[model samples]
Target: MTMGTAGLETQPSATTYELGDLVAQAWSGKVHVPHFQRDFRWTTKDVLRLFDSIVKGYPIGNLLLWVRRTPERSFTLGSLRIDAPAYEEAFWVVDGQQRITSLANALHPEGHLHDPFAVYYDLAERKFISQPKTREPQHVALPILFDLKRLLAWFRTEGEAVLHLFDEADRVATALRQYKVPAYLVRQDDLDVLTDIFDRMNNYGKRLNRAEIFSALYAGPEDGAEERLNLSRIADRLASRTGFGTIDTDTILASILARRGPDPARDIRNEFTSAGRRTAPEFENEDQDTAYAEGEEALVRAISFLQNEAGVPHLSLLAYRALLVVLTRFFAHFPAPEANTLRLLRRLYWRVAVSGPAVFKGSFTQVSRVLCARIRKGDEHGSVRGLMDTMAEAPRSLPTVERFRTNEAAAKIILSAWWSLRPRSLMTGEPYDAQDLSTLLGDQKTAATAAHVIFPRGLTAQQQLYAGNRIFLPTATDPVSEIPVMLMRQPIDLDDRTWDAVLASHVMNREATGLLADGDREGFLHIRQELIAGQLSDFLDRMAEWDYEDTPSLETLDFDNLDELEGGDDHSL
Candidate 1:
């Protein structure tokens, strides 16, 4: 039965079909997945959910197909190797590629060999599960059971042993054949009109990222000059070379605009569009080859500074991407800074990290523009000083123990700053290696395992549980005996001697531990905040003093051992 397009001036004919029929048509070379469609990206879980929805009778959404009168090319569907007819007219899916591909792979037994969509019916749970090849008696492979002859053979031989589960199997088989998918079939001949319809339909509720949009805009005809400007390829190459996980295309685009355009804050959507290029001549004449080269070099320099100087060796540890944008502009403007200027820049970097810049509202365009202007004028000191001053005024106040739990950026900054101290694990008396921390920092889950609460959350009041109360400890070490069970456990039932032993271990500063031992939770958090603030101040001060002649070392900052607590005022607590 034919249907009509929704919400359009000129309607196109549409149709509907049972899912089983759709899969049958796909296998027999009647329906084709178009070449322009993206690769199948649905995960195993997504596929499983689709089947579950079908069984539960939930609407799986509509499919848009172009009724091609004459096929222009040949393409494969899902992971299936079956040949689609190249010369015959067929229905080409414009929307619902994901759903159609998933249906084809799961319902057709031959489709499973080419794809990773192996699914099973859990006899006990009565749900679909994607399971690896196993001899478990309860799991009935969907492809095998969906075939009527195979299901009958299985019942004749071994079905009686689990005959009770056959009801669920029959239910699933019946649903698979009866489930109907709504479809639309358009007979449009204009390729451009079809492309526009496809894009508008896909982008209705969910918007694509700037990178994806820019990639589409910059992409050229099969053989055109704009093909070389593919933003996605450029970003991927940069990520591979620098070991920075997925350098975002928007970040790269922002750097290019900062270097070549009059205003870095121009509407990026318009800037990259055809109309934008025609209206703004700067985009046409700008040397993208040189801009990309300079941007890459500047990014390398900025990453180097973060790793070697700021103790932030991994991109994941960075609190904001805006910082990178600002740094890229700075480095691009001044490829090399004086030794003193470099020191000051380091302070500014950490300062912004610890206290997230408030000006990140508009992708940091204004802040980046101001800093670029200063750097262009050769006033490096003024640029850094002015930037820091603006950051200080950001809505976020100085970090407190409570803020640590809520603000992820603040927690990361505190953790990184504390790690800079190189505190030895109380159980082993050996310093934690920076390299180990760097590797762990690559992912948040792994990084969290690097630190454990000194006082277990269950033992402390909600207010006492903050950054100050946590201590960094390696989860595992070579000497198994070096692992501290006390730190890992709650302090609730431990005896006085055990408590004193833990306190004396000095995992944190002496003052903070003394307050904890005395059960002064308020005093402990207060003193801990001061100590963290003081360390941040002291570290930045030392960084600002660095000169090319005699570069100041981390040792000079006295972070190896907690010899001098920066804010050790007793009355403050």
Candidate 2:
């Protein structure tokens, strides 16, 4: 199956296409974006940069197309959807889907302005801007800029205000029309060869991640497969099922590997093949269906344990994804371990969160191997013991949070601790909605998306990003970023008891609320920080207790005394 340059159906023909022509072709379904291609991942900034490069006459990268007939299907190219018709000799994009999607959607009149593609050309500044709400004289919407009739109409209106900007606008429009992207078209029948080419291109550039690469090899449905074992779809399914939020497929893949074997880094292309194992692969290398199915179910159970038993309500609050991977393997092997074992497992979770995966010493792959090797198929207590054995000592202090980051370990730990208090809205006595929390934090990998600044507009940079200054107020659609704290529209007329309850729910004492009401930002922060630290310490200490006096095994436990040992848990957090 080694793909060489030779065994191709059609010779490579490198040529250029008018930018506008390509956009038209894409809109009319002359070119097909394959399922193996990564999603339209470029941000508005990235799209603007691509446009900027074209305007400057810089060479954006060449596109690779495999010329063949593609069956019609409803698909998404960025936020735009196409219910395509079957086509003959449709050029299937083997590379550069990102650039194609950006150009097609940004330059099309019907492209959704709601998503980031709504671009505008700023004639005065000579730059591309994203979703300019202000009807500026110098700004021409990209959809209109690319259309001759619309461009002239725009000139008659907003353009009339700034007569000097016309020449620059005209120049940019011409550049948009004349812009050419170098593309290599190959008429190859064997999709395997195309996949190889695609892999080398994206892998070398370091664009697609490992899980994406793993999924690409099996990204069928071009010729019609029953269903796809898409990692993205699996993660999305889990997110929708539980309010715990979306987990990255890369982390999910680790869970899959943990169930299958000790080494998660083994080549996924050969996951169920002879190359992946010393012994013969189970089900004769056709266990992909079983493997992913079992893996996904186990992952669901692991997430339930995290949310229900460990007080970690969302994926964003889980300090380490590796912890989930480990739990996935444990749960996959033993669906319901004894109550004592479950309690010990919860303790192990907190220890790793406060300290880190550093509890297991090695590289990522190495740590995965070591942790996964500890789980046994039928031996529940032994598996729990192996994991608990890793945590030799509990962390004496709560994790420090110099800055608030959703994905970072320390910040996730802090957020999880605060979430245990079930932060209520200041205006309402109700607890923050888990659905709202999950929705806001779902797509974020940077600073906590669920977190917002308590103080509006007036804090220094250091004070603003300080971990203490951030709060998870999920119910607020629009944060009070513009108004002063005391001047905010949140009802200040609540009775003192109601105010006290609201303050308590936010992890703030009455003193902190009074300070905030009095315009004492410094005092408010200090008081809140102290209160948060105390609560966080108490929570961590409770989870750190290594209650290890259980019988040697699940069978060894005396049936009569079991109730006493598990009664205090009240069936967990």
Candidate 2 least-lDDT 10 residues: 480-489
lDDT per residue for candidate 1 within 1-573, as digits (tens), equals: 123454344577666798778888888777776544544688888989998999999999889987766434344677776665554557778788788888888777767655457777787788888875664666777776677777767766656567777878787888888788889888776665676676566555454544444444433332343335445555656555655555566776666665554355555545534453424523355444555666677788777777677666555556666667777767666678666556667766765665453544444556566554444435555565555555544443344445454226666665666656665545444566655664444334224555555455434566445666566654455333323343343356555555544443333455665566676767776776666677755554454332223234343345634544655565578
Q: What overall lDDT goes with each candidate model? A: 0.61, 0.75
Choose the strongest candidate by TM-score.
Answer: 2
Q: How many residue pairs clash in all the candidates, one count each? A: 1, 0
TM-score of each: 0.68, 0.84
lDDT of 1 at 532: 65
lDDT of 2 by residue, 422-539 (tens): 8776555567767768777775554355676666458887777667687767654543463235223346577667666666766777667677778798887787777877777887
Model 2 — TM-score against the truth? 0.84
Candidate 2 CA-lDDT value: 0.75
